[model samples]
Target chain A: MTVTLASLSQQTGLAVLDHLERSASIPVVHGLQAQGDLIVIPLPVIASSVKVWPDSHWKDVPGEGVELLRGAAGGNPHTLVADPGTCRWTTHVLDSDQLAIGVFETSAVAYLLHPEHGATGCPPGTYVIRRQREHEGQRARLVAD
Target chain B: MRREAAEIREEWLGRALSTLPADRPAAEAAISGLYHLIGLAPPRFHWVSSPVTALTTVPPGIRTRPSETADRVSAWPLPSQFSSLMRQLCLALDAQVRWGHQSMDRLIRQKVRSPLALSTEGSLRMPLLAAHDSRHRFQSTWYDTQCVSWIAHYDALRRAAGVLFTPEQNRQLDLWAAVARSGGWWWPREGACVISERPVTMRTEVCGDDGEVRLHSADSPAVRYADGWDVHAWHGTRVPSWVITDPSVQRIGREANVEVRRCAIEHIGWASYIDQAGLRLVASAPDPGNPGSELRLYDMRRETRVLLAVNGSVERDGQRRRYGLTVPGFLDDPIAAAGWTYGLSAEQYSLLLRRT
Candidate 1:
């Protein structure tokens, strides 16, 4: 499922509350927009392997990872980095027009876990957890190649 | 706290008295609203020139007059009665209104902490959906928040009259008040003080961003609206369900040969005594041949105190009706009944018979 600012802004507070009350976690297909093109990538890939901060971007090991260039690859990019631990799930309406989705912390990724390259490799591509069969005390499965 | 209570009492009384012309209509409106808040019908009130004199000697029905003739109204300003009224009103109000925010509960606590703040002037807005009734001379309208002021005012009058009751008798009065307020149908069921209502089950399910469906079993009943759900659970039982009429006078009446059910589970094993003319145990008995339980009668105010051995029959004496008390066999103390009875398990006897 694709989530855009328009689609998210249209959702009601009750819907948001229902999700927060019953769901342990949500799966988001995250990426970044630069210039104009979009670079689809897994959150764990960047949070663990790159020196990605709130304002600063990879200026070029850009490491030994896959180079994902979207739109014009040279312009400064705006991104939202959410710490899975700190994000609050609520349906509180902050204002009449603006609904609070949640808060995200911008932090640097020091290591990325890879099946073959241990915790030092940064793999490219969008990844998400299979939430269909998830139950209490059960963790989501990483569905990324 | 004493000073605060004093302030509350003073302020509440002042606000209550100030709200009216204090006519029969005004008094009736307040009383009607209080009854409606608790989902009860208005009791038949016989108008008297002086309610103070009339109420001094009374039967089952309680009496009250308007605030205009302030001196005529009895049972005001007494701590025990006033506090009891406050507590009762709070309970009834809680059951009727559904709040939108948790902050509302906190606000009520703060406002009602001192009785003075518990007036219609308080910030709480409790709007009860009133339907039209053409039967009455005039349509009755009452809000729970507004009723607090009246309760304070009337109870202060009761205090001034120097009305007093023993703790046990007070408990009975409270019970009678609840019954009267709830239109005489509210009773104890499954450890819950509930009006006549059916049971319900609530299930919560969410569709995740990944299109996955998650199911949850919720104990509270919830309302689904525009993507949000508000849950409401039965908040256990309210106190004062016990009515102690005509103090304990041992009377060993007819023997109703009723079978007593064994107390199996803790929640199921209970009994109660409702004093109709005199004290009689109301309990459910185990059916030896049938699968479920039966109605067994027990008289608490007797030396024998055994199950009234009546063969499944309601015994009546002339103008007096002697209904069998459906009490649980597990209860060692007769006074501990919950105004209802439950079926007991076979192993429950060991638990009950076990001498500690």
Candidate 2:
């Protein structure tokens, strides 16, 4: 049974749902958060959740996948998690050190050994981060020349 | 200075009368010629300018006959009235002359002041005294030159009056006498008089002699008279004429052409109103103090002199209307060309000339 991280998160706490949904794939959830009016979801969950999530949520979600979602959600201290395949969980990753703990979870299917590996599997709704990287590169090149 | 001018004017009047023509025809010709020169139609003549032609050594062909003469003449019953008019004219002329002299004197005094440096305050200082001097100079020049023409006119009138009438036919003198007694030919009394045949916008007020003031529209029938020395004022784009009892009260009602002395307690005098006719008439008197104080005729056409008791009442169908006022149409006569030309600045004269 394939279930979106958003559906699992709605049924359970964000931490427990994330652990289940990211068992084998990145899970993305798009909707309002419990803390404020802002929208929050895991970056990797977009690709896994897009087909299952409601059409309204999919429309308002950013187009460049999970990297963009992380960029918007990154600065604040709050953590989030995602799974790219199978049963997805929308969960929080509390810190950079805690990202390793996901390998021990019962539903874990793959473990990203490096942050770069997570970047390579980035899901949808993360275009803003890519654009920001491209803009910085252009500015750096012009200054150098 | 005005009194001096008046004395000189009286002497000139006597000289002018002595120069009159003895022959009726010559007298009539000369008088008619003078009238034409001054822009008036020939007046009716009796024994002096017509039948009395044989009494003087004037040629019969030289006389200009009147278009028509009344079969009878009215008696000269208003002697004091006539004399008063003459006195007013003399007084006006005297005032004009005195004003010119005084203005010149003022200019000279101003010129004697030391010139000041152009500091910030100095730069801001007004040049009023200099302007006044220039104005006075202009007046003095005009008066000195044009006064002769005025004297000539007076002379001509005196001689014509002497030669144009016989003792028996001199009743016409009563008309002139009445005009004089009423304060010259164009003098309007100091009060309100019905002046126009048309309705107009008007404002009226009761101004106390002690300085109390009130105002209203002319359409209102009830108006409180100003107390003794108090003045009832009225003015507007169009004003209905009414009677004024006291000359002083009328003077107080005037609101224009007033000048204050430097002392802040003396007004120079009131401005005169010269109607389209050659009549120089008094319009108002200035307050003793207050330089800016003046009486203005909102409707010049509607302001008229109030005939006094001395001039008698208006008569209608052999019935006497007591305490009446008269407005002389002679000023409005088609041939009359009266106006103020002397004692004005170039700009002022231009304005007057344009209006005329």
Candidate 3:
């Protein structure tokens, strides 16, 4: 079955903007992809910087979806959406720079839905999700766009 | 039970951030009831337009205490006495909860009480306190007691969690709820009580999973009062008005705070600021996942260079937003700098498939 913004919005009961192409099937990518301030990369790509803990706790991504990050001002979240039992997320991954929010493993295609940025599909694999940051004078501040 | 607690939390949160005019009569009656519990006569009512005004001026009939004055609203003992009264009521209510209900009680504290407390602190108390003094010298029990988060927690216990309360305890809770819903912060004294009116306008952004909010506005004051007292914020970080109104390259250069400088630079788009500041471009390359978009790197400060990138998706107005990310000055390659942001190597980022 083809997955579009309309179908994801309907599946999660979330509203998407009219400006987005509602009917076009979303593409599934197997490589590094970014959405707004978050970047999703395959686990092996950043193995030096990210490590999964031995006692990592993982939770299944429910049918409703799991919210990853909520954008500032607009307050819309980047939700990781997939069929139940197909994916799980763990926040116990260690990042050298402390940027990783979690690691997600999906047996099937996983969709990340957002209101303004539309939706992007992630093919089955283990991926690390990290937030963007900018250098301040002497500090590093997380980017919240 | 969590859902029910959330509903109760929303109801109280609405009242906490309310900009509505005060209900004078209801406030006075509930306040009188509270005074009656403390063995004092109903104090005369003193109303002020803002918390700052309440701090700067004393009520007409009362002499002042140094601790209770302007920025030192912390040292007052009366509010602590009221806090004790509340503490006793909570201890009584604690007895009514059973073993099974204890977990529900903890969940209520997490889902409703703690988040509400955080929201109250961020949205109301912090801004008002900063307005008077930035050091935050005064104790917060005075304001913390007045915050409806705790009251709402108890309310959830009784109404939603089905915990029983003594008739007298319920009566006191009702009085506290009435005073809270009636108006803003209040100060109880020996023979008088002072109350402040809510802000005339407040703008906030949702900042947390549990419905927390913080003040934020781009061009206007995030919070304003009937008087002219107002606060300007940039995405929840309090900032000077110039950062919003007149963000110039010179002003940004002179600004000592790096966060403020970033906010100001961002107020003007990164691309525009780079152009206006006349920073030399180090390198530019096509963004792999974004198809037509380009990633340009520019010299920003002594040890930092900014990478200007275009949004992967078009906005509602048919324009793509340009954003800047500050990276270490060492990296000369735009793709390498972008990879450093996510802890990836230059080669790892080149395989980017899509961005949207």
Best by lDDT: 3
lDDT of 2 by residue, A29-145 (tens): 222111110112233322232222232122211111121222111121112333433222222222221111111111222111112111012233431111101011112100000
**Least well predicted 10-residue stretch by lDDT in candidate 2 chain A:** A128-137
User: Lowest-lDDT window of 10 residues in candidate 2 chain B?
Assistant: B190-199
- DockQ score of the complex predicted as candidate 3: 0.67
Interface RMSD of candidate 1, in Å, is 32.6
Ranked by TM-score, the better of candidates 1 and 3 is 3
Writing each residue's lDDT as its tens digit, candidate 1 over B236-288 gives 11101111111111221221211111111001212323333344544445533
- Please give the ranking of all candidate structures by lDDT, highest first, separated by commas: 3, 1, 2
lDDT tens digits by residue: candidate 3, B145-199? 7889889988999998888898999999999999999998887777878888888
Clashing pairs in 3: none
Please provide, for model 2 over B23-73, each residue's C-alpha lDDT reduced to its tens digit, 9 standing for 90 to 100.
344444443433343345654443322111211222333331242111110
**What DockQ, on C-alphas, does every prediction get?**
0.01, 0.00, 0.67
Top DockQ: which candidate number?
3
Give the winner by TM-score: 3
Ranking by TM-score: 3, 1, 2
